[model samples]
Target: MGAASVKPTSLPISELLSSRYPARVPRYQRAYAWNDTQVGDLIDDIKLLLPLPAGTRGHFYGGMVVIKITDSSEPSSNVYEIVDGQQRLATFCLLFAQIAARADELKDQADSQGDGEEAKKLAVLARGVRKSNLYYQRYDVDEGNESEQPRVRLSRVDDDFFQSLLDGTAGPPSRESHELLENAANLLRDELVTPATDATDLADARGKLQRLCDAVLLDSFVIHIVSDSRSSGYRLFSVLNDRGARLTVADLLRSHTLELLDDHASSREKAANLWDDILTEGADLVDDFLMTYYTSLTGKRAKREDLFDDVKDLIFSATKGRVEILAALQKMSGEVSTFKAIHAGMWPYVPSEHMQSVTEWQRSRLQRLVSTIQHKLSHPLLLAARAHSREDEFAKLVHMLELFALRYKNICGAHTGPAQAVYYAECKRLRGLTNGVAANFAALRKALNTLIDKRAPDPIFRNALKDKLRYDGGSPMKANLKELLTVLEDYRPWIKQGSSGQPRPSMINLIDLGQVSIEHIHPQKPEVIVPSLTSHTNRLGNLSYWAPSDNSAAGNKPFALKQPAYAASVVSFNQDLAELAAWDLSALEAREEQLIHDACLIFRP
Candidate 1:
């Protein structure tokens, strides 16, 4: 662990690629993931630079690339582990290979047409490009190995496919191959074969390709940073690449965790697979899951900027050995699905035997609570409770969480700063309980009452619902209001019973709410309005759900005209509109009071 020597210099893309030092992406690195967007951007950048003055020097193509130098006994060559910019290096190799392939194809065409001079010139250019940059020249190594391979080798997972692309023998990418690498190759091939803007004959195409090749090899430059060890390389990589088009917190964390487990390959693979499984849902969600998990375990908000540091601390502090660290990560990974299920509002179908005693009704309630509240503060609490608590205890826990979140944050408009810490602390407490489900359920209720100021009669929530419920137009709160109304509608005694003697809530087709739009009971711009009507137009009393088509049709219409649309609605809230004799301030107040009363009961803690 000696201090790493660092050197920074600008190198032409050609010198960087053609240098005797061969680049290798370590096995722990993620597979090549540059898709069409990235590939196209690089092409566009190079194409833009191609038309610049021939003498233009030091044109920056991209950010820095950091390599960890490795000792090679052979004097003729060197080997370096790619610490950063593997994507760019791999892509450059593919682009250059495609250019060489296109040049050779043009050479053969010219020779076939009896154009010997043109064919010879093309052949020389192609040979020079390939020989100088694309591959290693024959050399003897001290370890009895001879070198003659591609100048850039990808991570083991992608090396074979990358080599195939370099050799011009790749078929259409197989399902098993990395899609991004295939896409990058396809993008390069398409650009080389057919110019996007200007159609070119064989000669013009060759000229354009040669210009691109020259521009990339000679004109485009990168800031090359060479480090001596993996740790130094990673530090440099973070400093350089943490800015534009950056790696995510999860990416850096994944690399760090895998590096720690390097000596235990099987353990490393297990951790890697678990990480992949977490990402399989979506790459962006891993950070979210981690943040939630971290908050739950530590009872502190995990900032994205500090996520890697915090995770490293947690892993190392929990256990010093790699085996213990891997075991801890495996345990954390196992809980990922539960968080994911909760995030997706799919707790009912999570397929865990622990959830078997939890009824569909309870799951439905949990889903509604999560979807409506739409906050992350309660996720850790709920997830930890689900993992450690029994079904009945989990049901009670979800109820307490739903009440607190909806009442305190949603309706009361309280900031989540205090609540997040409390919820996280509760998560830890729940995890520690021996009879966690039942014991923690009581603990959560008591904590909510103490920390959030749970009043005996709960007048604070009811008053807040009445006074602060006015949703701003086009705000997310307006949507939350509609969802609240739907939940209240379902809770009404009017819901019909099924043959099984249970309330058939599914009869309402709540999925339609996803498409339904909120409408003003009192027209937004009424043709006839009594005094004080203007003030009440956007209040909760004035709003009801309507189908989009119906809402549009009822636009600015008088109450009498809009009554027919309300009468045809299935919502219990809308049905009350049919009985209204007039759309006046009194009517608005009456409806508002009734709705508020229902809400107080529906969201009662």
Candidate 2:
């Protein structure tokens, strides 16, 4: 525990990976958790150091704390457990594996070209500078010890999959960690290969690839802090994480809660497992979930930076001991899935066992609507309602929220302040109903209805739907237009159905509408047009969904020339357009009126 017992050394990854002392990410540690952004950022940073000189050092890759788990004096006999820096270390291993693979591929190309000298050079690069930099040999004669092991061995959960990344035999990911690992490998491989694969000059590409390898292995450095024992390493890990520059709310909260449970090893271990499960389940939404989960439980709006303090306040106020704290965490763990489901627009449908009565259309509707609007403020309320209400009741709550977001936020362009206040208040009220009685649901529904009616009155909503819903070239309007057309297509009576009466496939996909274009029925820039109809060209009635090809081909042609394209289209919106006898202001106004009526009826609370 003394400063004398701890030793820290600054070394390049080349020295670390080339050393006989192997590093191991403990089984209980979290899996390789960096997402695509972090992985890409690391590669991009290294790319800045490209064309590295022979003896020049590149960027410092920060630090890691590892405990000497074995007491053996020989390096080969000792193993270091990674208490911190698993993500970085694992990422580097992945980087090296990809570079090695790229080098071997080039070597194969050289061999096929009958260039023995280039082939030999690439083979050395593939094997690394030393014979065993990527996978060091264990010199210990212990019968149980394997002859060769990866310099950085990941946890048991990801070790096999990590190996598959090196060998290039990975299949679909069965879990989140597996997916992350695969993504990192794929991203790194793509970056490493693109230059070499695209180069016309083989020697230049090979030199660049060599510099990349050297930049990673010889230039990038980390301060390797060696600890005397696991406990000491863990204490240092806690200190480093608390003061780390990139410390997150999840990190701070986890460290504080675990430190509080340190007295009971059993409770601490159980809590650690539960924490990992919740983090994995939350995935990229971990921070968002922390804020929303806290808000939902307390019915108070919490900022991300202030979340740890807010959570600590709750912990001190509500819990007395480790058991009580653990119980509180267990309850929080139960709600993580609900938060994830809500963010994914799945809600009651995710836990399908408990939500048997929730129909597929209901789930799809929420999913589509959520994708079309900014539903961040609605999360806390949705989480609270899902926790307190039954499936049927929660379905009603989701519909109410969707209508509010679509009408008030998306179409009417209302300010978010008033809506946020109403949502937070309802969240608090719903959380107060611990037993979730019928009267409580009724009250919440009534309040929500009143808010919706007040914010998005019939006349205001109808006018917006008819006029403001037109395409204005902004992404928000484009999304709103797509949402409107997709809903109309879903409600169209002519849509084909199965023998089982399930609705036909939708003409436009609400989730990903990038390929679908909003066609101007009246022609925005017509080759021939009546002067009076020019002003009505951008009306909601003038727009309908068209495939990119049809939109390009129509090309400002008059409705006469566009009629054949519309008649050939399968989209119900276009089919409706084909039925029109001629293009005029009267027809556009009539269609806009009918659309307004249908939208009002379909989105009714």
User: Highest TM-score: which candidate?
Assistant: 1
lDDT of each: 0.69, 0.72
* Reference-based lDDT, residue 306, model 1: 76
lDDT by residue (160-227, candidate 2, tens digit) is 88878866788788778889999898888887556534565556667878777778777788999999
- TM-score, per-candidate, Cα-based: 0.76, 0.74
- Could you tell me the C-alpha RMSD of candidate 2 in Å? 6.7
Candidate 1 least-lDDT 10 residues: 495-504
Name the lDDT value of residue 239 in candidate 2: 76
> Against the correct fold, how does model 2 do in TM-score?
0.74
- Top-lDDT candidate index: 2
lDDT score at residue 502, model 1, on the 0-100 scale: 27
The residue pairs in collision within model 1 are: none
